[model samples]
Target: MEIFNNITIVSSEILQEFEKLSSSVVSDAMDILNLEHGGCLPHTIRPLHNYTKTLVGPITTVYAPEGTSLPVHLAMATHVQNRVLVIATDNYKSCAFLGDIQAHLAALNGCKGIVLDGFVRDKDGSQGLDLPIYCTGTYPKRPGKADLGGINIPITIGNIEIQSGDILIADTDGIVIIPQAYASTILETAKKKDASDAERLKRVKEFNYNFASNIHDFTSILTKDVAEYIKKHM
Candidate 1:
């Protein structure tokens, strides 16, 4: 699905709230709601470095170039503040598709962070940019003579499928791709899960789970309380 034209502006309060959530917890909450996993590569197998603030938005991907980088960059360069950049290589080539120079340019042009399926050159140079960069690896070779392959099109990185305008959320832990249609519901459910986890943590601290019971026979009571809480709040 295309990004909901009715983009919900993420507020400072919401962003701050997200900061308190572990990416794993958020993913687990998504699973609890039975949301699609979206797509992800093995974090251990990838050497991606995140440099931008954690935020979510529709994605826009670029394929390997067949010409100069400007054509694709200009085509995909957007003013969206929190959009995710997902660029895939044409052939899993060693040639770099993204680098610090392009990342800096994208940041200045108001694009969000980048997730390159291919290599990004100049890792050390990227330390100075405020933009987040996630890539397969770093290479000394800069993107060779732009437009060598192709912007704003669907592509896959590391075999993880991606489409333009799909919601993406990345943090220190890793990335989470949320289908566009599920954005609102996912966010709302996540709020509920966050509150529930907070309360459960409190209970665990106060009562200590080890002292509670062997099989934890209080499920019915807890379920009733949760139902009432949801009814009251939502």
Candidate 2:
């Protein structure tokens, strides 16, 4: 199914604003809003040690075989400005799905980062690179076959079905996949949550306690409001 009519560009403004919000805050924001965007698996696969920037952009999904690299190359060749390349492999055990070379290319193309739900290589090689990369694991051994995958098709990562143009947000906490059509809404909810969090923090600071029980807080925290908000908005 078509998830979005057109690619809605996530302006650097929103991205920058998002970056200002801590990963814990963002996770809490998603939780407060009941947005299903985080909780990626195999947390051991982390953003390369030298990686500093949080990556955010629409998806350019790829699917490839274990021993092939063409799909990776194709995804890079098609990389549009601000896009995040996501790859779902038919074989998660075949080989590394990404490496220094592909990541460097993606960075050169104005892409933000990569979310390879399978595998990728190059920890030392990934250092000093300007891109943020996340994967299931790193493979010291090179990919076995090079002719096995496709790009720009629907694929599932972390067992979540991702379509082309889905919004991918990666930060220290993990990756969150939002359908492109809902990117704006997610941001709106995030914004709202940020406001709420600010108030929550204010109240806690004022109360000097671990919990809030004041009537003002009971109405303001709205932990139960998420369900109602989604029903009203989504």
Candidate 3:
């Protein structure tokens, strides 16, 4: 369909700012603006490795129906550089639609990260690929080679709608999709939310430190008073 031939990806300085914030902070910011789904993907989608770093980039989408992967291969051939490739696979969980070889190719082609609404394999072997892969789970079966999918088209993964030009910010916590049209407004709120969280964390740490050493609280005093009042009965 040549859908990606003229696609326009909006790159902005606000995206650079978003790179500094966590996904939770970004989701909170989206909530302030009443953005759809609060920019959250499914909680089941997680990085292949536990220590994977944050991924921040523009998006290029693929709609690969269950058991198909030709669209992902086609998009990677030309359109994926410096972008996070998001593939929606009709929520298929029986087998993996991606694997180590594709991940290696994605790294070699300068792709930033990969997100699949389905599953992937070779998580242990793909360790050195250096490209972050987020998916629902891992399986041993491979995907079919049928060319039954589309690139750079709108797709819904776990009820979160995504398009080619969206900004995808993913971290250890989860993924958050920010529409390019509101990047500036969302950035304004995200920075404020991040700062507020930092202040709140600092106060909480100090309170915890104090409470640990001075735990003779009202409950303890009340217990002692009741004990003394009942001493005569004993």
As a TM-score, model 3 comes out at 0.84
lDDT by residue (tens digit), candidate 3, 130-204: 798899989999888775878988889877899788899999889999988888888889999888778766655
Report the number of the highest-lDDT candidate. Answer: 3
Model 2: runs farther than 4 Å from truth?
1-45, 209-234
> What lDDT does each candidate get?
0.59, 0.66, 0.82
Order the candidates by lDDT, highest first — what do you get? 3, 2, 1
Clashing pairs in 2: 63-150, 64-149, 65-148, 65-149, 67-144, 67-145, 67-146, 68-145, 68-146, 97-119
Q: Between candidates 1 and 3, which one is better according to lDDT? A: 3
Winner on TM-score between 1 and 3 is 3
Question: Candidate 1's residue-wise lDDT over 1-234, tens digit each?
Answer: 112233334444544555556555667667877864464544732435544457555676666644234434653455245666666564455566666667777878777677765666777777867677776676666555543443555566555666666666677777766655555566677778878877876765566454546333334236556656655665
lDDT of 2 by residue, 169-204 (tens): 677787777666555666777777778778877864
Output the worst ten-in-a-row residue range by lDDT, candidate 3.
214-223
Off by over 4 Å in 1: 1-22, 33-37, 44-52, 65-72, 75-82, 90-93, 145-150, 209-234
